[model samples]
Target chain A: AAGVIQSPRHLIKEKRETATLKCYPIPRHDTVYWYQQGPGQDPQFLISFYEKMQSDKGSIPDRFSAQQFSDYHSELNMSSLELGDSALYFCASSPRGSGRFGYTFGSGTRLTVV
Target chain B: QKEVEQDPGPLSVPEGAIVSLNCTYSNSAFQYFMWYRQYSRKGPELLMYTYSSGNKEDGRFTAQVDKSSKYISLFIRDSQPSDSATYLCAMSVPRNTGNQFYFGTGTSLTVIP
Candidate 1:
């Protein structure tokens, strides 16, 4: 079975810099999701993409944006990063829009904003 | 109030002990409950998922949901050292567009050998 994959497993950026993280969903999956996990905390929903369109934006600020190129790929962008932006960003995929089977998550990209 | 609440504990237990993890939610609209296990430096892996009320068992893991109390739980029997990880409780409400999930802060477990 194909698993979700993320690029740039570790990243370091200065404050106010722009950072982009990429993810490839499992083959045959339709919906993709992005989440942020702060140190010692659970993952927080960032955004979800379906049908090549942005579906939902969570409590994240506008400085964070995401895009889905196709059914199998998505990207998360953080512009003008702050020290608070430093966290582990995860990508996940689901076969359908409903909550039938839970999401399969990627290993995540560890972002450090200095 | 936050939709979901969980205790973030570095709960330590001996091997072969049973472990109980739990979460509570304030959102009555939440219809799906899930438990995920995340190892250090790794993404979360789905362990159990339940809809609404009742209990579901798979091997050594059992998941229970009580809609009346707005509580959900994951019970692990015969816990092993390999089972040491963070357990996250998540739930979602049905929406016209898509389901959005709310996650708890997660509880870390350390199973001593």
Candidate 2:
């Protein structure tokens, strides 16, 4: 499989500006996930989409939102960014109900909120 | 309390030495346990996964889960310098809502030649 693909491998934004990142899931996979990893920390769950509908959201603030397209592509949007928002963002894909074996991840997008 | 806890160590070991990594969780409902390895400035890669309580081995890596104690471990045999990286432990409970995976702060490992 070609695996998950993410766009804009690196991003820089000024405080209060908006940032958007994109992801394209592997072919035939219906579940997409987003995660954030700060320096020296583990990846934290952000949200997931399955069948073009939001399936779950983690402890992220309201400023963070995501959408899945008809083609199984996904986007993560950050509004009114703050310095603390700087981190690496990852997108992953998996087949529905496949449990642990379904998971496949993308190289992350590093964001620096100045 | 955080659902999962792990010792974030900059652990250094010699090549060919055995390495052990561990994590503890407070959520008794978790039934799926996993270990991931991440290189610096890259995405985390799945290493091993287990359901409930048991041991799973792949190549030189072994994963053990103990549901009764809410503990899990990953052991690396004949460790190589290429094994140097951060190890993260994660678990998930059965659910269709919200992010199911809960992760611990990773433990950093360095295998010295």
Which structure among the candidates has the greatest lDDT? 1
lDDT by residue for model 2 (A3-64), tens = 78999999999999999999998899889999998888778889899989999888678999
Colliding residue pairs in candidate 2: none
Q: Which stretches of candidate 1 lie over 4 Å from their true place?
A: A98-100
Q: Looking at candidate 1, what is the lDDT of residue A2? A: 78
Query: Across residues A41-62, which tens digit of lDDT does each residue of candidate 1 receive?
Result: 8788888888788878886789
- Which candidate achieves the best DockQ against the true structure? 1
Expressed as tens digits, the lDDT of each residue in B1-113 for candidate 2 is: 78999999989999999999999999888878889898888778888888857889999999999888889999999999999999989887878553388888999999999
The deviation in Å at residue A89 for candidate 2 is 0.7
Tell me the TM-score of model 2: 0.96
DockQ, candidate 2, comes to 0.55
